[model samples]
Target chain A: MQAPVLGVKALFFDVFGTLVDWRTSVARESEKILGALGFDLDWLAFADAWRGEYQPGMEEVRSGRLPFSKLDVLHRANLVRMAPRFGLENLSDEVLDDLTLVWHRLDAWTEVPGALTRLKTQFRIAPVSNGNISLMVDLARRNGLPWDAILGAEIAGDYKPKRQVYLAACAAFDLEPRQCMMVAAHSSDLAAAAACGLRTGHIARPNENGPGKGEASPSVPVDVAGSDLADLAGKLGV
Target chain B: MQAPVLGVKALFFDVFGTLVDWRTSVARESEKILGALGFDLDWLAFADAWRGEYQPGMEEVRSGRLPFSKLDVLHRANLVRMAPRFGLENLSDEVLDDLTLVWHRLDAWTEVPGALTRLKTQFRIAPVSNGNISLMVDLARRNGLPWDAILGAEIAGDYKPKRQVYLAACAAFDLEPRQCMMVAAHSSDLAAAAACGLRTGHIARPNENGPGKGEASPSVPVDVAGSDLADLAGKLGV
Candidate 1:
């Protein structure tokens, strides 16, 4: 293995696609809840539509059209907006709530648990995603991810790609941005993080969007790259 | 066990005196560092004097006299103020910085780890402390305190007994105040938490101060009380 990057004291992860397999998990959960209701829509497309609204939902807050709100609240609003299009317009609050909470029960990519446990020995590891604190906590509890702290949008009062979100996570550790590494599968997320002076690590998630969706890897160079979390751990010399 | 307080889902702890024996730990760290520098003074009294300034320091921000700042920054200021009185007028920047970080190395009370471990099995546990996130993370890592998240002054932008701190912690869990319990050794802290509609758990740290300092338990009634964390865990049926 190559020598680990020097002076990196913490690892901040991008959760939705980089760590948790939200696509499959959400699809499974939507199938269970919607199937029981006798709604036979394409669950994966429903999941994609729900997720596609994430950026625009955050953009409302980011653009100051709406005040800062938790991701869960934004997600619920988006879910409500999409329900009618998906033919589940009359779903009860109970079903809607369960479908929304599927984000909390997301399955971590196969190597997440052990890789994080290994990396944690050498560095403080935390999520720096757009997920709100409660959602992050529930996801951590459900997936057994060992996080040193739950930090993200709710903690920053803003979503990622916002300079404050990245800087605030670094400040939370009392460390300089260069002393931490932002790990994500998306080039755009890493580029935003790198612009804020954080070191970058990339985990290639070629199947993050499901079999044919092909979510692309970083176009920009990263300090480290791995096929999976275990590969990242190995390369980090953890 | 009496049903674990019905619907209590999270336990928020007071860190300084309740979970950690800060007086002892701070005194020891001070003695070790200062003694090596050829200084001799009332170390325990120094610890108390340093800690006694906590609430007043926070009041500056809570009252809006100053903008929000991390506890570490406030702690350094307090250390600077108290330095000359102990004949440490010429302390170097590095030494002062190290001394300020002693709060990060406090030892947990003997029963804390096992008790928290047990309680974590049944409910979320976190520190609702005045210490900044970095300090809390350091203390957790040093002492094996299993926190679901670090929530406190940093997140709330205000110090405790302020409704914002308690409310923010509850909000982080997406919980009502009544569904969360404030666990502390100080009645005043618990009382403030109760005023915000949270349940309260009392842990008796009769020796939190120096041997004869005689720190007292809660003067008001608490929902649960125990001689130590183990006793508290047993009482909570964890």
Candidate 2:
């Protein structure tokens, strides 16, 4: 399918599953933490369950079913509820606090840093994810992800698929929507960005759900599509 | 006098006259533009005259003496009034628009990027300047300065030495005032940050005024003092 060629001055990325593999990384780190605590549990199951709390939590706030809250607060609330379900109990507040920070320890995809470096040479690159500023900043520092700035839902006062979130980024950079591009693995994200007049690029992360798992195919008319970041970088001539 | 050792988590910089030698840089850039247009005025004098407008312009906004304005707007206003002084009359709107972006092209101190790199490994480094977000972002990109984020007076709706501007940086990083350090060559800037409970580090840019010229030394009680960025880094053990 032919896609429109776009002229983009800046690129905003979706941080979690799109730029970094949060699932496996969080699971591995949780497993290590459990091991250190002399406990055994299904790490992958815990990771999926932890991530399962994210969407509904965001939806709750987005729909005004709950008051405006930061992602860290939401993550902490979900962690407290999920701890006992994982056959873990009697955790001190300090331990729970450290565990809640699992989201901060996400691992970047192998292709992420190099691709971002190449793109940074040609365009303004930043994170326009639903993640809060501190979480995103910590993630970038820990993973060596080079971001020009952190533009997130906190600045938008709303979650993804909302025009406000996308527009907030454009406003922050003082660019018209057409001058900015959104890069994501999720069709829903690109759809929202495209609807808001931002150019879109889709980098397929087939392994985002692990082997034999597939995310829904992106349905939006993105300006570019590639199997991975390197392909996207090549396509953009970065 | 022995200064108390400060434990600083992040180093927030003052951009315009602190990290960037704006006077010299702006003078040189404007000279080139004027030279191309066959103007033969004293470029240094013109640059100084142009910069002289910055403070009064900002003060007008700060004192509620004028309506709220972005630095870009203020800069443009100043540029329009100063243009004829440099013999650049009847300039086309497009050329004038380009000239107004002179603030976006300010050059960084020679030690800025290298010192920032070293500090970044240990602390979150950002610019808490009066420049707007877009201006700071573009400046960092243009000069290859590795800033973790750009926190500006525009975000706080007030310019520095204002308490809100210093406190806003602390709030953005989720850091307490004492945990953050304000590093600047200007005593007034550091004093304001100190009043907000942030530790202050003074890096003496004796040559900020360019060759054979010097920046005025103002008295302020900073936690540390160093001769240059390299010295600051050394003192901080970064």
TM-score of each: 0.97, 0.92
* Highest-DockQ candidate: 1
Stretches > 4 Å off in candidate 2:
A1-3, A64-67, A87-90, A214-216, B1-6, B64-69, B84-89, B209-218
In candidate 2 chain B, where is summed lDDT lowest over 10 consecutive residues?
B209-218
Candidate 2 has an interface RMSD (Å) of: 1.2
Residue pairs with colliding backbones in model 2 are: none
Candidate 2 C-alpha error for residue B194, in Å: 0.7
Could you tell me how far off, in angstroms, the CA of residue B30 lies in candidate 1 after the best superposition? Answer: 1.6
Q: What does each candidate score in C-alpha RMSD?
A: 1.5, 2.7
- Least accurate 10 contiguous residues by lDDT in model 2 chain A: A1-10
Interface RMSD of 1: 0.7
- For model 2, residues B1-238, the per-residue Cα lDDT tens digits are 1245456788999888778888878888876776788877777787788888888888988897886667888888888887887667788887777777878898888888898889898899899999887889878987778888777676677888778889978887888999898989888898889889999888877766656455444477888887777778888887
A78-158 per-residue lDDT for model 1 (tens digits): 999988888778888887788888898899988999899899889999999999898888888888888899888888988
Estimate, for each residue in A1-238, the C-alpha lDDT of model 2 and write its tens digit: 2235456789999988888998898898887777899988888888888887888889988998887677888888888877789777688888777887888899998888889989888888899998887788888888887888888687677888779999988987888999898999998899989999999989888777777454534676788987888888888876
Give the DockQ (C-alpha) for candidate 1: 0.82
